[model samples]
Target: MQFENSREFARQLDKEDKLSKYRNEFILPKVNGKDVIYFVGNSLGLQPKTAQRYVDEIMKDWAELAVEGHFYAEKSWWDYHERFSEKLARVVGANPAEVTVMNTLTVNLHLLMVSFYRPSGKRYKIICEEKAFPSDQYMISSQVRFHGYDPKDAIVEIKKRDGENNFRTEDVLAKIEEVGEECALVLIGGVNYYTGQVFDMATITKAGHDAGAFVGWDLAHAAGNIELKLSEWNVDFAAWCSYKYMNSGPGNASGCFINKKYHNKKDIPRFEGWWGHNKERRFLMEPEFQPEPTADAWQISNAPILAMAPYLASLEMFDEVGMPALIEKRNKIVAYLEYVLHEIDKDVESSFEIITPADQDKRGTQLSVFLHGEGKELFRYLMDQGVITDWREPNVIRLAPAPFYCSFEDMYEFGQILKEGILNKQKV
Candidate 1:
């Protein structure tokens, strides 16, 4: 697959792309009256064109039926969250009963930790990647403190080797084995936010279990971007935000997967709410809390229908296309993006180092590049020229060309814009 750095080549590839038509489904943003090349879908996905209609339907129901809309609307408000169970299950590779949509990503992770992160004396340590997303860091440390343990002692972070940007699976496995009897849980982000590295979740999950520990993943960047098999991997629990890569709106509701073996356990520790109670007797307000025999047992409140409406709208698109088709396009587009970056690097005075893994299976839609001899000014130039990418600390720029809306032309054009920005910097 030789990629060329020309508009004609890009357009030809687009002409042959089967998923290119799906780009029209999203409402891309504009810059200077033209569509911007959006590469921040790993941060906030573009709004699906159908999202407005989904919300409008809910708004109409509320206005027309008031409280009765819970039971009477075409998509009833009371059971709205249930709409995601099957669709989300397919997306995350789990049984319908093992998945549910609920609170935001970190909130769901905290709730899930209650049931899975049971830290007993001498076995209270948690293993996670070094420099995880800040929200996860806070969640894990706070959870440890809540149980009267110091984070310094209770949390073990797996560090990347010197001069390396990604964690090796062998190193992570060795750390888990080293922690051994003291490790209570192995929780890591499925796709790293900074480097776009995809961890070997199945092998890590097995190693954690073999060492007598629970394993889980925060799929904030992996949910729709990578293939996940939570049930097949025997993950104890997992959670992910729908906003990133799922094409849901900003800070939308999240999805969760809890293995079936933990479904009906009466002694399982979790914060309960009426929404999690058996649907048959929920309104009856029974004295005892009989949990739903599914992942819904972890629900702490009723569905946030307004927030979830956009998510359901996005899921409809995912259902139509399916993960396999999405992955197929993702691999090609990301490779083209990488190719365009390298080709541009060859011409520019500035050097660009891609920190993401070269293997498609070990990475997703994102390509984090270290722009040597460049700074925020170059990033601003790209943004001003209608390229919407993300910048992390230091000099790394994260470009996630979401396959749904991003095209090969976007990659080629971005390379031109980037090269121009670097060359212009040299003139000054």
Candidate 2:
């Protein structure tokens, strides 16, 4: 698909886009009283227009039924989270029973690690990618410390080779084999937050299992941004937040996936709560813990219905369009964005590098641009020009043209603004 640096070309693509109508479903943020070009869905997704209605329904239920809303409300607060399982299961490619909405991402990661990260004797090491999200790095370090092992010794970080921006899949697999006998867990982000590289999860999971390790993924950037097959990949577990890409509200409840193979295994250690207990005997208040025979068994508390409403609303949209359609639009739009960036570089003589994988299959919606000459100042200029993107430390600016809302015209406009920003720097 050859792209031209013209608004007409962009608008023509928009005219052909099947998912263009979805842009209307979201309420775009304004800059100078006009909708800003939002390319930061990797950091935070725009809010769904229906979000208010969903929350209002929950509020109305609480107002009218009060305590009885647990069972009496239209959606029933008692099982509010269940409404998302089937739809979310499709989103993550898992069995309905294996997927469940629960606590936030890091919290779920800790809970899952409790069950999947068990170490004994000499096999206590954990393998993860270097420069993981700060929370994950902290979690791994703390979990290792909690298990009475020094992080420096027990945690192995796989880093990119010198002069590279991303890790090679073969190198990652080799590292797993290198520590096969000692590694107990292999956890990594499905789509790396910084470089936007999408790891080969299926191959990685197989390699981890052959190495006798439990493998998990933090899909914080992968979910809703790329197609995932957690169950088919034979992943031990996975977790993701709903705010980014999924377009749920800020600090919204998260989704969890536990392979069906672990569903009926009561021997798996977990931090359980009453919500995870056997539902039939839940109100009976049994002294002994009887776990649910599903992924919900890992849940430590009842559903946060109010917080989950926006996610339910967003999932409805996902269910309507399905991942296949979304991925189709994502590929075309992101390719257009890539084309625009290169065009801008060619026209403006800008010195910046795209750190993201060039292969569409190896990335999601995000493209991390590492500015070379005037990095921070160019980023600030784009921001002042109403290009809503995010700046990472050192020099990278992350732009995620989300398929659900962002248009081809937006990408074209961004290219123009980026060129202007760089050319303006030359004048200075």
Candidate 3:
């Protein structure tokens, strides 16, 4: 438990880390004419250094093959999407047949909801966290209205009382019961964007099933940030973006999941396109839709091979290091951050509250700090001083030390910058 400065601590951790070599694979950005601490991996991840090479391969094939690239490339573009399924399936703890890499995040959400949210007369409620991301709220509300139902009454959000910042499992279970027969779908973030709180996906999925409802998750911030078992959890469906902890670059292609149990369930309708048509007869130019019996059936159009190559390389990195080791270092790094944040004077604690859960098991790699007096001002100060992080509207500063590249030393060094920014300088 004894460590010196952030540098010493990081060196010690690096020496013991089996996955330390993985950092060499990504491109890290510098700030303020100096190398800055990047704790915002929960927002946008650093690019994989190999990403350019991966894309260049496809570019070379495209340049040489032209129209023939579909079947003639080094890796056939027609079946290139298939390459990622096996590795991506492993990251989410799903069978290879149940995962597919496709579409941007919100687009996938709407598509998955089309199949999951089959609202009827009296059963049209959607259960989600009260502070769910704005995009999700829009999607849910719009979906409810699309079904001739008012979102005001149909969308049920779970919340905690005043003076409380975290939601309890029992409370969520109780709410699901209270809304039982009426609830049609349950959607929650695997790890909430603002709070960095990891919800109990398996438990929530069970509760949703007991109530005869579909369960889905938005793993934008959680996908590669934590270990997930969506298939084993029996989650009806799930979707995630890869730009964050996956180091796939900004606006990279996303991934989706459809339980193996529902792969052949034609009754669960999906928005159809030729890409999703049955693989055996994909190029036959048939009018009838023949969906594949796995998550591939959910695909709409051809995925951008170049955009997805980064994810391919990143997922391979995950397989190389494994999740347990990353999670082990992640917990220690985050705990150090919490310890450093708490070491600040009580007066500062009274002003800047750590909204993210403190328990190692309840959260992942990030912490959301809520500033009372002047959050924006402090944010600007930190930015000017080369301390990089993200800000959520109203008052939260989110800092996430990504496990792949972030070290404990970076966390401790930033802690010093935070103290100076908040305590030594005051413009408000």
Give Cα distance to truth, residue 193, candidate 1, Å: 0.4
Best-to-worst lDDT order: 1, 2, 3
Task: Per model, state how many residue pairs clash.
Answer: 0, 0, 0
Candidate 2, backbone clash total: 0
The segments of candidate 2 whose C-alpha lies over 4 angstroms from its true place after superposition are: none
Model 3 worst lDDT window (10 residues): 343-352
**Candidate 1 residue lDDT tens string, 1-428:** 98899999999999988899989999988999999999999999999999999999999999999999999999998889999989999999999999999989999999999988999978999999999999999999999999999999999999999999999999999999999999999999999999999999999999999999999999999999999999999999999999999987888898999999999988999999999999889999998999999999888799999999999999999999999999999999999999999899999888999999999989999999999888898889999999999999799999999989999898899989988888888878
Clashing pairs in 3: none
Which candidate achieves the best TM-score against the true structure? 1
lDDT of 3: 0.84
Candidate 3, superposed: residue stretches over 4 Å from native: 2-7, 346-351, 426-428
lDDT of 2: 0.92
Task: Give each model's whole-structure lDDT.
Answer: 0.94, 0.92, 0.84
**In model 1, how many backbone clashes occur?**
0
Q: How close is candidate 1 to the true structure, as a TM-score?
A: 0.99
lDDT per residue (tens digit) for residues 1-428 in model 2 = 77898999999999999999999999998887889999889888999999999999989989999999999999998788888889999999999999999999999999999999999999999999999999999999999999999999999999899999999999999999999889999999999999899999999999999999999999999999899998899999999999999999898888999999988777789888999998889999998888899898987789999899999899899999999999999999989998888888787766769999999899999899888776688888888888999999898899999999999999999989888888877987
